[model samples]
Target: MGSVLKLYIQVAFAVKIVSCSITMVDNTTSKSPIDLSTAFLLRVDQSGQGDYKRIQEAIDAVPSNNSELFFIWIKPGIYREKVVVPVDKPFITLSGTEASDTVITWNDSGDIFESPTLTILATDFIARYLTIQNTHGNTGKAVALRVSGDKAAFYGCRITSYQDTLLDDAGRHYYSNCYIEGAVDFIFGNAASLYERCHLHSMAEESGAMMAQKRESPLENTAFIFLGGKITGVGSTFLGRAWGAYSRVVFALTYMSGVVKPEGWNDWGDSSKQRSVYYGEYKCSGPGANRSKRVTWSRSLTKDEAAPFLTKGMIGGRGWLRPSPTHFKKYQTS
Candidate 1:
C-alpha cells in the first residue's frame, strides 16, 4: 500500500506542471483569455543556462510581424552589442532584474540615426530595469537610444550618453522613473511624449541644452512634456532649445537644480523661432526655477494652461500602455 501511494504522488506532481503551461494571466488589466501558445517567453543568460546566451539572439528568434506578445528575460550581464527592434516586430518586452545589473552598451559616435546603441523601431515595445549606454564620450551625435516607433514605453531604465542621449523620434511614447544623463541636446526629437517621475542629469562641462524639440508646423500635434521629476546637472544648461519654428516643451510640478541656466531657453541661434516656439513652466520649484531671468518668449503658465499636459491623456496612453507581465508562458528554443 505504501508503494502505491508513492507512485500516485509522482503522477499528481507531473499533472500540475502540465496544467501551468497551458494558460497564464494577461499583462493588461482585462481578464481576457490570451492563448499561451501564440505568445512566447524566452530567457537569455550569459552563463549558458538559459535558451539564448545574448539578448539580441533571443529577440531574433521571434517571428516577423508577430501578433502576440514576446517576453525576453535577460539575466544579469553586460551585453556589448548594438541592438535594434525592427519596425515589423512589435509587442515585445525586454526586461531585466535591475538597471545596475543588466547593461547594454556600445561605442559609436557620429551620425545621429546610424550610431545609436539601441534603436527601437517597433511599436508597442517596452523596456524595463535595464541600462542602455553609449560610451562615446563627448563626441558628436552619439545617441544612446533612438525610439522611432509609436506607442513605446520605458519603465525604471537608465539611458546615458554625452550628446543626444535619447533621440525621442516620431512616436507617442511614455517614460516613467527613468534616469537619463547627457550633455547637449540630450533629449531631442519630434515625438509626442510624456515623462513622469524621471531624473534628467546633465554632464556638460560648461554650457549645454537638455532638450531640443523639433515641431516643424503648428498643425503637427507633437510636444515633449515633463511631469513630476527632477532636473539636476553638472554644468549650466538651458531647459530647451527651439530646433524648429513651432517647437513646444513644457515642465510641470518638477524640481530644477542650479545647473539650469538663467536664460532657461534658447532660440537655437534663430531669432524668428523665438516668436513661434512655445516653452512653458508650471508649479516648478528649486533654485533654478526662477522666471525672473527666463527668456521673454517663455511662459509661466497658469493652472488652466497647464491642465492639458498634467495627465496620461496627453499621449493617449490608457488605451495601449501595458504593465509588466505577472504570468509568462514557458518556452525554449535552441
Candidate 2:
C-alpha cells in the first residue's frame, strides 16, 4: 500500500528468484567455451565477433527443453529483427549492453495476430538492460513487446511503441526498473504482471489510454499492477480502459503528471464495461490524480486490497522472479 512496503515486497520477491554466480556480458553473446558447471554465456555482436550476429540466431542456436540457464550478451547496436523465444524454450536470458545502447527493433502493424517486435513465449525467460521498440510509428496498433510465456521477468529494459507498447498476453511477469512508453492501450493484455519502479509515458494526440486489460472471467488469474512508478507525458490520457468484461488495472503509490485525465479509467464505447472492469489507484500524487473528477465506477483501493499489488505473490511469480543485479543508470522522467 505504501511506497516503503512496495519496495520491501519487491526486494523480497527478487530474493526468492535470484540464485547463482555465472553472469554474461555482451554487445550479443559470450563466445567463450561455457562451463555449464558455472553458466552458459554467449556473446552477440553485429560485427560478427560474438556467438551470433542477430539475436534470433543466438536464440535459434539454443538447445530446446533446457533446464539450465542460458545467457546471451547482446552488443551495443540497433538490431532490426522480430525475435521470438518459442514455447519449448525455457530458462533463457538476453542480457544487453545497456537499455539505451543495446536495441532490438522492428516495424509491424497489428493486422495479423502476434505482430510485435519481440515476442517471448517461453517460461522462465529473462531480458535485461535493452530497448525493444516497434518503429511502425502511430499508424495503427503496433506492438513492441508481447510476453505470452509463464514466469518471465524484465529488468531495467525500455519498451517503446505508439499504440501498443507491451502486450502481456498471458503468464506471470515481473518488470523492474523498466521504461514503457506508448500512446493508447500501450500496456495491455491479460497477464498477471507486476511493474515496479518503472515509468509509464503517454505520447498521445488527444485521448489516450495507458492500459487495456482483457480479463474476461472472474476466475482468471490476471491483473496489471503498477507499483511505485510515475506517469508523465503529453496530451490527455486515462490510466486505463477495459478491453474485456472483467479487465483490471491498478496503480499504487505512483506519480501522475498533468497529462493524465482525471477520469483515470475509460470503458471505451461500452458503458457495460464500466460496471465489470476493476480499475483502482491508491495514494497516487500529481495534478492528474485529482479524485474529484474520476469516475464513480473506479475506486480508491483500501490498504488491504492495495497490499497484494506490491508483492510478487499477486502475479503468482513468488519462487522464480530472481532479478540479477543491474548496473543501469536510472533514467529520470521528471
* Most accurate candidate by lDDT: 1
- Over 116-231, each residue of candidate 2 has an lDDT whose tens digit, in order, gives 98999899899988999998998898999989899999989999999988998998999999999999889988999999999999999699999999999989979999899899
- Superposed by TM-score, candidate 2 places the C-alpha of residue 331 at a distance from the truth, in angstroms, of 34
Alpha-carbon runs more than 4 Å astray in model 1 = 1-39, 332-334
Instruction: For model 1, give the 10-residue run with minimal summed lDDT.
Output: 11-20
What value of lDDT does candidate 1 attain over all alpha carbons? 0.86
TM-score of 1: 0.89
List per-prediction Cα lDDT, in the order shown.
0.86, 0.81
How high is each candidate's TM-score? 0.89, 0.86
**Model 2 misplaced regions, further than 4 Å:** 1-37, 323-334
